[model samples]
Target: LPRRGADTPSLAAKRGKIARFYLAHASRANNWDLVDLSAPYIIGRWLLYPDADGKLPDRGILDTLASHSDLWHQRIGIVATLALIRQGQTADTLRIATRLLDHRHDLIHKATGWMLREVGKKDPGCLLEYLESHFRDMPRTALRYAIERLPEPQRLYWLKRQ
Candidate 1:
C-alpha cells in the first residue's frame, strides 16, 4: 500500500512519511513474498540514507525487528539488510545476522544466511571470520547458505566442523 512520488519538495520528507506509514501497518505484511518485495525498498532504503536534515538515520529499528516476537517482523528485520549489503555496508547485516542466528524459524534462518551470503559476495573476509567464529553453533541451513560461494575445501571444512 506504499505510495510513490510525493509532490512535496523535500524528497526525504516524503519518503520518510511513507516509510513510517509502512512500519505502522507492517503487521499487514502477512506473507514472506510481501515482506521480501517491500522491506528492502522501503525500510532498508529509508534507513540506509541520511534524512532531509542530513543526519544519519538511527538503525535501532533493525534490532527491534530482529528481536521482536513476531515471525514476520523478524523476517523483515533480517531481510531489510539486503539493501545495505547491496551497497557494501555489511555491518548492519552482520549485526542482525548475529541477532537472528539462533532463531527457531526456518524462514529467519534462510533470510539471515541469505544476507550473509550476500555479505560474502561483497566482502569475503568478513563472512569467513563470522563463519569461523560461529559455524559450530549456527544452524545448518544458515551455514550452508553462507558458505555456498566458498571454495569446495573451505565449504567442506565449515560443514565438517558442525
Candidate 2:
C-alpha cells in the first residue's frame, strides 16, 4: 500500500521515493488488477516532479518509464505525456502519441486521441491528416475523441464514417 505522509520540508523527496517504490512494485505485478491499482500513485508522482519551469519529465525519461511491463502504467505514462503536450511539449508529445495510437490498450487509444485533440487545437490540419490516415484503424472511441472539438461540419464528416 502507498503511504500518505503529512506535508513537510522533504515532502518532494518522500513523494519521489514513494513513486519509485510503487513503480517498482507495479512493474513486477503479474496481475493487471494490481497494476491498475498502482497506476494512480505512479502518475501522481510523475506529475509532481514537473521541472522548475513546469515542464514534464524529459522525453527520454518518459520514454523509458513508458516501457514498464504493466499496461496500466503505460496508459498513465501516455496520459502524462499528453499532459506535457498540452503544456507545450509538442515534439515529444507527438512522438509518444503516435506510438500510443498503435498500442493494443483501448485506454491508450483514447489517450492518444485526446492528445491529438489538443494538438488539433493548435494545428487542425495535422489532426485532420492523422485522422484521415488512421481512421480506419483507430478505435471508434478514439476517433470520436480526436474529432470531438472540431467545427460541426468537420465533426459530422468524421462521425459519419462510423
**For residues 58-102, what per-residue lDDT tens digits would candidate 2 score against the true structure?**
446556656665676675555555545544545555666666665
Query: What does candidate 1's lDDT look like per residue over 48-107, in tens digits?
Result: 666677765688999998888889989889899898889889889988999887889888
Taking every candidate in turn, the Cα RMSD to the unseen true structure, in Å, is: 3.3, 5.9
Query: Would you give me the overall lDDT of model 2?
Result: 0.63
Model 1 poorest 10 in a row by lDDT: 1-10
TM-score of each: 0.91, 0.60
Give the clashing residue pairs of candidate 2, or none: none
Model 2 clashes, total count? 0
Q: Candidate 1 has what TM-score?
A: 0.91
> Best TM-score goes to which candidate?
1
Query: Residue 100 of candidate 2: its Cα lDDT?
Result: 64
